[model samples]
Target: MWIFGYGSLIWKVDFPFEEKILGFVKGFDRRFYQYSTDHRGTPENPGRTVTIIPAKEDSRVYGIAYKIRDSDIEDVVSHLDFREKDGYERKSVMFYPISSDQKPFEITIYIANQDNINYAGYADLKDIAKQVVKSVGPSGPNIDYVFNLADAMRTLFPSVKDNHLFELERNVSALLNESSIRKST
Candidate 1:
């Protein structure tokens, strides 16, 4: 069974997996809509997805593809279904490899509800900052999601650099600092 990781699962896979390969899916993009109850939750209720949409651009989303045992696929799918909620759908995607020698693979992708989507396009640093700061899911703040993505990207594909998330994080941190100062005043 093949599993795709575009967010926290990229860095934090508690389960055992066989192999991980770098892959990308075109047209669709990644966002921090899924929340984390494990990291920051009130105990009673946890982990949820925030309403966020991908940017309207011709870009590739980098993620890891894991080959798991067929027996374990059920467990993994169950866990993912719980995390993604009922609205999200799992669709198969063709993952293109970054290396010329490597072959592409097909994997499942979790897509959000497009009928009512929340577009998170950053017009400037401030817009990106606001999106990061305000975005929260069943899990936690969207910042954690970005940090996880950054960590995974560094570990898995050190040579490949994607700054869309990092730039947003920087903008959010700056905005957070400004907000704190304003609050103090």
Candidate 2:
């Protein structure tokens, strides 16, 4: 079985995989529309996380696809189910590998759609940045999630443009810098 990861899973892989492929899934836009209560924030102040939203047919969300060993499928699924229990659900989608020799194939992805109870939906980038800057949970500060994801995407897919992600990263970084300067003054 193959699992597709576009967000934290791209950089934080706690599972074992036989093979990993750089690829993308079409017809979706990655957005910070999911509230992360358990991992990045508390119940009182949830931090936003990426959830794929339906977009134009040509839209592509670049990510990594991991091939799970047949023996590890059950264990990996159980672990992911608990890890993504906040709002995500597993769904099958076609993944297009970046390598020319690889063909597109069906793979599972965890997605938090609008219908999820923990979905934060849309918000201005500034508002999102402010929330992220102030939020922290068991996983660590919310800013780490945004910064790491933006950095990972840039490192893994240099030419791809993820405006929403990069914009949020910039907003959060600026906010943090301003806060640091204010404290120093």
Candidate 3:
């Protein structure tokens, strides 16, 4: 079985996988439209997190795809279920690897439902940035997730255009800088 990780999964894959491939899923755009009330924030203070939205044009989300061993399927799925307990569900997605010989294949992805209570969909960059700046939870700071994922994606697949993600990252970074300047003064 194959699993795709376009956000935190890119930087943190706790599951054991036999193979990991750098890939992109077409027809979806990664945006910070989900509220992270579990992983990076509490119920009262939700953080901004990435979720795929169906794009009108041919869009792509670049990330890592891991191939799970047949023996480890049950355990991996169980772990994923608990880890994604906030508001995500399994969805089949096609992944196209960076390798020349690799062909696009389907993999399961944990996508948050827009109707879920934690869904922070449709918020502009400024609002999302503000939420991310002040939120933190068991996993860590919301900003860290943004920075880490943005850094990872840029480092791994530099060609892929995740404008929404990069824009949010820029806004977050600017907010952080502003906060630092305020404290210094």
Candidate 4:
């Protein structure tokens, strides 16, 4: 079985896999529409996180795909299930690798749909940035999550464009800079 990681999973992989491929899945647009109360914020104030929305037009979200060893499938799946229990549900999608010689294959993705209780559902980049800047949870600062995922994407797949994600990162960076400037002054 295979698993896809488009967000934090890109930078933080706790599970063991036989192989990893950098690729993309179609028909979805990554957006900061999910609230991360468990990982990046408290229940009182939630942090913004990426959750793929079904796009009207064909869209591609680039990320890493891990091929689980047959023996480790059970353990890996169980770990992911608990980690993504907040509002995410597992769905299978085709992953297209960057290499030309590789063929597309089905992989499991965790998606937090609008119906989920933790769903923040569509907010502007600045608003999302503000939330991310101030929130922190058991996992640590929300800002780190945004920065890490953004950096990983740019470093791993420079050609692919994820406007929402990149724009959010820019907005968050600006907010942080402004905050530091204000503090210094």
A best-first ranking of the candidates according to their TM-score comes to 2, 4, 3, 1
Highest TM-score against the true fold, candidate:
2
Best by lDDT: 2
Better of 1 and 4 by TM-score: 4
Please rank every candidate by lDDT, starting with the best. Answer: 2, 4, 3, 1
Q: Per-residue lDDT for 20-128 in model 4, tens only? A: 9999999999888889889999899898788898985578999999999999999999999999888999999999999999999999999996888999998778998
TM-score of each: 0.71, 0.98, 0.96, 0.97
Segments of candidate 2 deviating more than 4 angstroms: none
Candidate 4 segments exceeding 4 Å error: none
Worst 10-residue stretch by lDDT in candidate 2?
Answer: 110-119
Task: Specify the poorest-scoring 10-residue window by lDDT in model 3.
Answer: 53-62
Q: Each candidate's lDDT (Cα)?
A: 0.64, 0.95, 0.89, 0.91
TM-score of 1: 0.71
For model 3, what is the alpha-carbon lDDT of residue 150?
85
Please write out the lDDT profile of model 2 over residues 1-185, one tens digit for every residue.
99999999999999999999999999999999999999999999888889999999999999999999999999999999999998799999999999999999999999896787899999999999999999998999999999999999999999999999999999999999999999999
Using alpha carbons, what is the TM-score of model 3? 0.96
TM-score preference between candidates 3 and 4, better one: 4
